[model samples]
Structure formats: C-alpha cells, structure tokens
Target: MQDTLSNKALLKATVIAVFIAGLALVSFILPAEYNIDPTGIGAKLGLTALANPKAAVVSGAETKATIDVPKSVQAADIIEVIIPAGRGLEFKFAMEKFKKMEYQWQTDGAAIFFDLHGEPEGDTTGYYESYAIATLADMQGSFTTPFAGVHGWYWKNKSAQAVVITLTVSGEYSVIGLKK
Candidate 1:
C-alpha cells in the first residue's frame, strides 16, 4: 500500500541522516573543534588549525613562549597579586606605539582564563584589541606595542580557591596597577 511505502521511506531517511551526522562528528567536528582526531583524518585534511587559531596559545595545558630578554628589563618589576575565588581582575601598563615589553606570568597551579589586550588611549567606544586569549596556568613572551594605549591582561579565576598571580615584566612603559 502507499501508506506502508511512505513509512519505509521515512525510516530510511532517518537512518541516513543519523549516519551522516555521526560521520561528520568523527571526521570534521571533533577534529576542527577540539583538535581530537582519533581517525587521523582531521590532521591529514588540515582541520587541526581550527582549534584555537591563536599563536602560542594553550587551552588546558601549559605552553611556554620564549622571548628574547631586552636590556630594558634591568628595571623590571615583579608584581604579586591575589585574585579572590571566582573573581576576575585586570592589570595594565601605559606604553607608546612601537615600544616593546618582555613579560611572564603564572598562577598557583590552577588554570585560568586570560585575555591579553590593549585599549587605545582616550577611546570611549569600548574598543580593545586582544593579542591572545587562553585558559592556562603560565605564559611568557615579549610583546611590541601596536598602538599607543593601555596594554595588559584580564585574568578570570573560575575555581573555588584564591589564585596568586606573579607577573614580572620589563619594558618602556609605566605600570598601571590593578585598580587602573
């Protein structure tokens, strides 16, 4: 009968849809989104770069970026900050265009979300350029200022315990401490 044929066709369509979804998950979604390609097809097809797209970024592990130590670091300042549990904080520096800074920061064994960014001086549009954003415990690198502004980091602690952040930096800029 026509009714039976329609039912059978619907079942076949459902099965085909499910199969395609599963295959896409294994082939594209897992590799492109999470960088976990169990079948190695993602790597072969160059889908792994879709994971973070940020250079020297770490999601859940420590990835250290080595930067050349500049002579300006002779006046480097090491600041220790304690971020309360389940809170966030911002620390920054005032620098001119084309200036450079070498820095490193680390948390007390807990991973946290961090956004390294810069906001141009006297901008009221809430415009900020993020250099990197990642969830990790430690990172180190040298950064050259792109434009005159306040450049620094905003770290958010998501754990129940307080996190102590020790940051050391040397640069051609003034420190605009935590409450700036």
Candidate 2:
C-alpha cells in the first residue's frame, strides 16, 4: 500500500509539471512587442520617428554625427532620435553627465554605455546615469530638457571601413507652449 501511494503522488506531480510547462510554452509564443515613446516613457501625445540628418558613406571616411539644436527648439523641451551604424559606434555626449532615453532595436544590435553627471530633476533627476552601470542596453525613449541645455551625438566606426549614420529620432513631444 505504501508503494502504491508513492506511485500515485509521483503521477500527480508529473501531471502538474507538464501542465505548467505547457503554459510557459504558450506564453513564449505570444506577442511581446511594446510601443514606447522616444524618451523611454510609456506613452505620450505625438508621433515618433528616427531623428537624424542625411547620411553618406565616403571612402576612407570616419562616420560622425553632430547633434544640432535648432534655434526654434525651446529650452525646456528635448528632441529624441537614433543614429544607425554598420556594426556599432561609441557614443560621446557633450554634457558632463547624461541620461539615455528608452529604446528597442528592430534587429539584434550592440549595447550602449551612457555616462551622465549632475543631479536629476523632476522625473529623471539624478546625479549620475549610465547604460552600462545601469541595466539599460540600447536607449530608445524620451529625454528631459536640461536647465542649461544639452545637444550632440558623437559616434565611432565599429567596422574596419567607413560608415555613415543618419540621425534617428523617435516619438513626439509637445513644445509646452507651441501653437500646435
């Protein structure tokens, strides 16, 4: 009788384990994509797209991107975009410290390390930030406008040859007081 009871217990455990495994397999097959703003925020009003200038690849050339701040851009708002590269590029920012907006790669891509300093204010206020130290990989979200202002995207060629990167911007944000 003891042996019979043990067999019944084992059978029940195996059945339960199989049911859980089937549930996990179904979850894996479901959709996993989530839509997010360029700033990394969950959702916001406005459209999003890659915000970069025209790109060209020239022989024996080093690819670079200069973040251009338009005169019309307000001080309190931030613009977001992406810079595409062949393999990958090293990102350097002009700010003493900076933050990376949230993002997702359409394909398998390299990781990025964001170095930021100073204190974060409002939502993203903090002293230092990094994509490397922190858990974030590729940045693909929104950014908070700084008090003094911030701009520029510097990248290095990850491949043996030259590469051209078009500034890629995503998401839409209101100008605070723009006419719309």
Q: What is the TM-score of each predicted model, taking all chains together?
A: 0.59, 0.27
lDDT score for residue 177 of model 2: 13
Off by over 4 Å in 1: 1-74
Alpha-carbon lDDT of model 2: 0.32
Model 1 error, position 134 (Å): 0.2
User: What tens digits encode model 1's per-residue C-alpha lDDT throughout 22-107?
Assistant: 99999999989998999899877868756733222122222222222222223456666666788787777788899998889998
Worst 10 residues of 2 by lDDT: 171-180
Flag clash pairs in model 1: none
Error (Å) of candidate 1 at residue 101 is: 0.8
Query: What lDDT does the true structure give each of the candidates?
Result: 0.76, 0.32
